[model samples]
Every structure is written in structure tokens, then in C-alpha cells.
Target: MRITAAVLEQIDTQTVPHRITLEQIELDDPRDDEVLVRVISCGVCGTDRGCLHGVEPYPTPGVLGHEAAGVVEAVGRNVTRVHNGDRVMIGFPFCGRCYRCLRGEQRYCEKNRDLTFSGYRLDGSGGMRRRNGEELAGRFFQQSSWATHTVALEQQLARVPDSIELEMAGPYGCSISTGAGTVLNELRPEPGTSLAVFGAGNVGLAAVMAARLTSVEHIIVIDKVPERLALARELGATHTFHASSDTVEEIKELTRHRLDYAIEATNGANLVADAVAALGMRGTCAVVGGSSPSAKVTLKHADLLGHGKRLIGVMGGGGQTPAFLESLMALQGQGRFPLEKLVRFYDFADVNRAIDDSDAGITIKPILRMPA
Candidate 1:
């Protein structure tokens, strides 16, 4: 099928910048284990920007949009979970046969790196190509959904409840789930505990909202942007702080050096040390941010070992299941989650402008609405 897609012709950098442009591409038919979807909306995530700016790895001439929601147009012969005409959100892909996957930890699937960044399927086949017969990397997160249509594995989709607007559900596939899941599924903070979130971006604010649903008493948010900090307060943060030299000290003072939990979602601000430093004795810090492949963090040894503080890395919110995504959608329907507050819609043709706004902090979450 011929489809319109925003193709990343090459990586963008200061010396040699490139922009994603809409181009007509050929899409392959669904494979035996895949399903075809006509995407209605897709979220522009920081990870997508990371790839565009050369901070993350993605092959050139590729389509890139993982947080997608749409109706199933067709299904492969073996697909049984969903049928044509069903509304669904594309989730992170995982090889269901991996040991971690069998243990209900699909986020850590053995082939996660390949499934997410390799651009092609594990079998070396891509789902899209140029009009000139050139292959384009299209299997990003197993669903390169920047295009009007996409083919993804059967396991990478979750039904979107009828009560929820499909356009508002795409971010739940990645950023929203990553932040909320880290708290609801992984942290599960005890009653009356204090939690601090670093970086009040989409992910961190999502954490703030999720904490409100929990027994967490104090939710502290830190960010350089005053507007984001104010928005964090509106989203349920009990306290908000400007990112500065004394930010950790302020958290320590507020929590009396007994901060129960902390989450680092700075998207490569390298705030892991500060997040860890803000923790109290035996406190745990969840690092859920994306960074360049070569980016590394250095933490004080005693801050972790001596205080018994734990620094754990969470990928895509620990473990993603269809049920988890549905629960979030249900919450949104009940006005409890309020994901709409963080969203702004854009036309699919303004893909680059949407991305630019997100990069400029002018937009919290940009959902590109595809043409019907």
C-alpha cells in the first residue's frame, strides 16, 4: 500500500542539520504475526526528538513514531487478540518467548534493543521502502507509526476503551506509561511517604499525577522551567522547586533528609546523582529517562552503598501489559488521570513544527492527528 509518512532523511546536528519531511512510501502487507493499523494519532515523545537530534540512534530514511493509536485495518492469520475495526494503542514490542517475557517482564525482553532501535525486524526485513526501491528503517519499537498506516506485531497492541478519546491515548504507550508505571507498578510507595521527581517534563508530571492516586503524602517536583514547575503543582505535586545548585539541599531540608523515594526523568539532564543524593536512608530512586547511548552517570559510591539507597533503571515503566494500559485509559475516562492537561494537538503535516514546539518547551505533549 502507498502511504504518507514523515521520513527522517538523516540525523540533525548543528554542523549538518536535517529535518523530517513527508514523503510517499510503500508499506508492506502484514506478516503472519502482524496487524495493520490506520493510525489516527501519535505522540511526539522526547525519545523521538533524541533520535532526530542525533542524541539517540535510529537509521536514516526511517519512519519514527512509537506512541500511536488507531483502528485495526487488518490482522495476520495468526492474530487472535484483536480483529479488524477494533480501536487500539500500539505498545512497546517484546519477544513473548524470552525468559523475562515469560516472567511477565516484557519491558526487559532479551531482544528489546533490537526490537526498539534496530530499525528492521529481527529477521532483517523492514516494513517500508522509498518510491525508488530504497529500504527505510521502519520497525522502530516494532511500530514506526509516523506514517498514516503501520504494521506491527500482534503482541504490541492494546485495545483502547470506548470511553477514552483515541487521540489522547497514544502517549500512554511510552512516556506516560513510563512515568506512571514506575510509580504505580514499580515504586508503589508506602502510605505517607515522600517522593521527589526530577524534571517536570511529560514523564515527571505523569509521575506527579500517578502519585496523587497513591498514598504518597508529599510530591516534590524539580525543574528549570518555572512554567513546568507550576504545571506540576497543578497536576498534584505537593511541592515544586526550581532546578538549581541547592535543589537537593532543599529536598533534604524539606524531607528532613529522609526522602522515601525519588524518580529521575530528566531525559538526559544527568540528574541521577542529584536524585540519588535526595534520597534518605534505604530510599530507592527510579531512573526512567532516555539519553544518548554513550551517556553515562557517575554516582557517589557511599550515597548508594553506605546509605543502602538503591538506584534502579526502569525501562518503559518496568513491565507493560495490556491491562495496565487499559487501567490508565479507565482512569482518564473517570477524570482521575487528567492526561488532557498535558496534551496539545497538531496536524500531521506540521510534524516538524510540533517537534520544534516540544523541543522549545512550548508544548507539553504533542499528539499529531493523521488525515482521514
Candidate 2:
């Protein structure tokens, strides 16, 4: 079927910067294990910006969007989890045959790198083609959804309840889930525990909100933006600190020298060190932010071994998506997790503007409404 999509002709250069043009394109029919979704909305996440700024790799003349929610317009044979006309959110892609996937840790699938960033099927075939007969990299995250229609693996679809708005559910696939999952699934801070979140962007704020639902007594948020800090406090943070040299000191004072959990959800490597520094004895720090693949962090050996502190990495919330995403949706329905507060909507035509606003920190979570 012919569809409208935003295609990046090439990577961003110093002079010829990244650009996406709206064009009519052809999308192949769904394979036996795939579904065709009529994308209603999609969210622009930091990872998307990372690709746009050349910090990440994505083959160009391709569509880019993983956080998408839409109706199932068509389903290939052998698909049973969802049927046509069902509302669903597109989650991260994973090769089900991987050991990690078999163990229910889909996020850590061994082939995740190629499955997500290869811009084509694992078999080296792309689902989209330009009108001029050129193949377009369309399987980004197994659902290059920054277009009117997309083909996705059946396993990647998470059915959203009718009560939840599909427009607001896309981010749950990545950014929101990454932060909330890091707290709920990985950290699992006990009641009355003290927790500090390092960063106040969407993921950080989502962590703050998830932390509020926990027994964590003291929820402290640290960030450079005063406004984000203020918003964090509103969301559930008991204390907010300006990101500075005194951040660790202030958190120490608040936790009385016994911070139980710390989460690093920022792109900056320095904050990872800070989060590690703020942990109490045996405290664990969860890193769930997007950084360059080549980026490295140096930690003090004594701070880790001597104190029994753990520095762990979490990807896509570190668990299976069905239960986790459903739990979040249920929480949102009960008004316990008000993730909707962070969203701002833009017309699909304003895709670039939405990216610009997100880059400028003018928007927390930008959801682009695809033309209906």
C-alpha cells in the first residue's frame, strides 16, 4: 500500500545537517509473523534525536520512530496475539529465539543491536521502498512508524486498553517504560528507603513518578533545569536539587548518609559518577540513559568493592513488555501514574519542529499526530 512517511536522505553532516522529507512511499504487506499498523501517533524520544544529531547510527532514506500506537489494520497469518482493529502500542523488538528472550528478558536479546538498528529485517530485507524503486530502511526497532503505516513483528505489539488513549501510550514503549522499569523491576527499592534520581528529563521524571508509587520514603531529584526540578517535585519528588558540586553533599544530608538507591537517567557521564558517589553502603545504582555506544565510564574501585555498591545497566526497563506495560497502563488508568502530564502534541507535518522543541528542552515528551 502507498503511505506517507518522513525519510532521512542521509546522516547529518557539519554543513548538510540531518533532514527528513515527507513523501509517498510503498510498504510491503505483512509477513506471516508481522502486522500492518495504521499509525495514529508516535513519540519523538531522545534516541530519535540521538540519531538525528549523528550520535546514533540509523541508515538513511529511512523512517524513524519506535514509540508508536495505532490500530491493527492488517495481520499476517499465524498471528494470534492481536487481530485487525485492535488498539496497540509498539514496543521494542527482540529475537524470540535468543537465550535472554527465552528467559523472559526480551530487552537483553542477544541480537537486539542488529534487530533494532540494522534498518532492515534480520534476513537483510527492508519492508519499505521509495516510489522510485529504491529500498528504504524501514524496520527501525522493527517498526519505522514515523509514517502513516508500518509493518511490525507480532511480538512487538502490546495491546492497549480501550480506556487508555493511544496517543499517550506510545512513550510507554520506550522512554517511560525505561525509567519506570528501572525502578520497579531492577531497583525494587523497599519501603522507607531513600532514593535519588539524577536527571529530570522525561525518563527521570517518569522515575520520580514511579518512585512515588513505591515505599521509598525520600525521593530526591537532581537536575540543572529549575523548571524540570520543580516539575519533578510536583510529580512525587520529596526534594529537588540543582545539579552542581553540592548535589552529592545535599543528598547525603537528606538521606542522613544512607542513600539506599540511586538512578542515573541522563546522557552525561559525570552524573553516573555522581549517582555512584551518592549511594550508601550496598546501595545499587541503575543506569538507564542513552549515551553514545562508544562512551565509557570510569568508577573508583574502592567506592564499588569496599562499599559493596553496584553499578548496573538496564535496557528498555529490563523485563518482558506485556506485564510491565500493562501494569503501567493500569496505573495510569487509576490516576496513580499520570504520565500524560509530560506530553505535548504536534501535527505530523511539524515533525521537525517537535524534534527542535524536544532538543531545546521546550517539550518534555513530544507526540506527533500522523495525518488521518
Candidate 3:
């Protein structure tokens, strides 16, 4: 089958428009622990932008996308949890043998990282390729969801309720998961805690909303974007600080000189310092953004010496797969959380345009709709 796709040919390069031609490709029956999906909507995540624009490193001419949701077209023989026609979200498939997978942290899957980051198969075979039958270096972060149809490992697929709109369910793959999981799984803010989120983008706003759901009394959102700040307030932020303003002072004034936990979702290293300074004793600051290869952040040893403040780096929000996503959907269903306002839809061919909108802060989350 030939499909329209956006292919990143190299680092610091743009995704070239190409028809991904496949030979010997099969929608073959799922293996004992695999599933096939017809992807309907895939969100354009920051990582997807990075890969297309070359911030993080992945193989060239690769299909790089992670946030995806679709309907199941087939199920493996051993699969019983879900059947054909189920709605699902997919990520990279991880081998369950490693210590990370055993600990329920499948994001750090040992085998798939090489397969995922390298844009090749576990056996080093390229999944997407050129019309000449030469490999195009694909399999990014596992599902390579920038396509209309996808084959997902059962381990990485989440069965979402059919009542949910396909577009609304796509972002749970990365943006929403990163924010919600950072609070619920990593930081796990306690009742009456004070929380601050830097850079009120999709991830940061999600964190702010999650903080409101918790007993966290003070939710401070920091961002240079006025519209985003307004949206944050609408989503339950107790206070919003304009980054152009004296944000640190504003947070201090709102917090009575202390912050319990802070999540960093920006590229500015100084924002990290501000988050650290705003914390009280025994505070936790979770850094969830991916910086450039040369990007660095500094901390005062004295802050940790006696204050017992901890700064933690979280990858994929340190969450357990499927469970975190399911929990969020359930909350949304109960009307306790509404994440639909964050997304904007676009045609699949507008991949570059969507990235530009996300970069310009014109759109919070962009979902590219494939032709049905």
C-alpha cells in the first residue's frame, strides 16, 4: 500500500512530502500479542516537531509521530482484553523482558529504544521506505503514527471507549500524558500544596488543570502568552503570571513566599531557577521539557544542602502505560476534566502548517486528520 506521509530526511531539516510506497507489506494477522489499527487521528507533539525540525535526534527520512488514536481492525489470537473494532491509542511497543518493562515503565523499553530512536526494526530493518524498495528509515518511537494505518503491539495499545471522539483521544499519547502523569505519578502533589507551572503550553496547562483536581490550593501558571494564561484560568488555575511581568515576584506574592511543587515545561533554564527559588522546604520540582543537546540548567548546592528540596527530571512523565491514559479518559467522562478545548484540527497534508501553528503558539495541540 502507498500512503501520503511526512518524512524527516535528516537533523535540522524539514520533512519532505512523499508518498510512502511499500512492497511486501502486509496487514497480516496479528501475532499472539499484537494488534492492527486503522489510525484516524494523530496529534502533532513537540517531539514530532523536534524530529521534523531537528531538536532531538532520530534517523533520517523517518516517520516520526507518537500521539495517535484509532480503531482496531484486528486482534491477535491470544488477545482477549480487546477485540476488532475497539478504539485504541498506540505508542512504541516494548519488550517485556527488561527490568524497566517489569517495573511497569514501558516507555524505557530496552529493545524498542534502539528500534524507535534509530528508526528501524528490532532486527534493524527499515519499515518505511522509498518507491525503489530501498528503506526510508522509519519506525520512530514505535507506531510511526504519521500514517492512516498502523500496526501496534498489544503491549503499547490502550483500549478507549468508543463514545469518545477520535480526535479528542489522540493527544493522550504524549502531551496530556506528560502533564497529567508528571503530577499524578512523579510529583504527586499532596493536598493543600502550592503548585507552579512554567510555560503554559499544552503540557503545562494540563498540569495546571491536574493540580486543581488535586488538593493543591494554589495553582500558578507562568507564560508569556496572554491567551494561554486566559485558557489556564478557565481550566482552573488559581492564578496566572505573565512571563513578561516580574513572574518570580508575582509567584512569591501569590504563594506567601513559598511554593510546594513546580513543573517546568519551558526551554528557558532560568525558569527552572525561578521554580527552585519559589519552593519551600521539602519541595519537589519536576522538569518535564526536553532541552537541546547543549541546553544546560544549574542549581545552587546550598538550596539542597539544608532545605531538603529535590529537583527531579521526568521522562514521559514517569508514568505507567495505558493505566494513566485510561484514568484520564474516565475523569473526562465523569465531567471532572475537560481537555477538548486544547486541540485544533487540520488536514494531514498540513503537517508543516500545524507545526508552525504550534511553534507560533497559535494552537495548543494540533491533530492531523487522515482521509477516511
Highest-lDDT candidate: 1
* Minimal lDDT window, size 10, model 3: 18-27
Compose the digit string of candidate 1's lDDT tens values, residues 34-61. Answer: 9999999999999899888988889988
Show pairs that collide, candidate 3. Answer: 8-61, 9-61, 129-136
Give the lowest summed-lDDT range of ten residues in model 1.
288-297
* Cα RMSDs, all models: 1.0, 1.0, 3.0
Q: What is the number of backbone collisions in each predicted candidate, taken in the order shown?
A: 0, 0, 3
Candidate 2 lDDT over 266-345, as tens digits, reads 85444788899998899899988777777778889998999999999999888796668878988998899999889999
Q: What is the lDDT, from 0 to 100, of the residue 114 in candidate 2? A: 90
Evaluate candidate 1 by giving its C-alpha RMSD to the native, one decimal.
Answer: 1.0
Which clashing pairs does model 2 show? Answer: none
Per-model CA lDDT versus the true structure? 0.93, 0.90, 0.75
Error of 1 at 345 (Å): 0.7
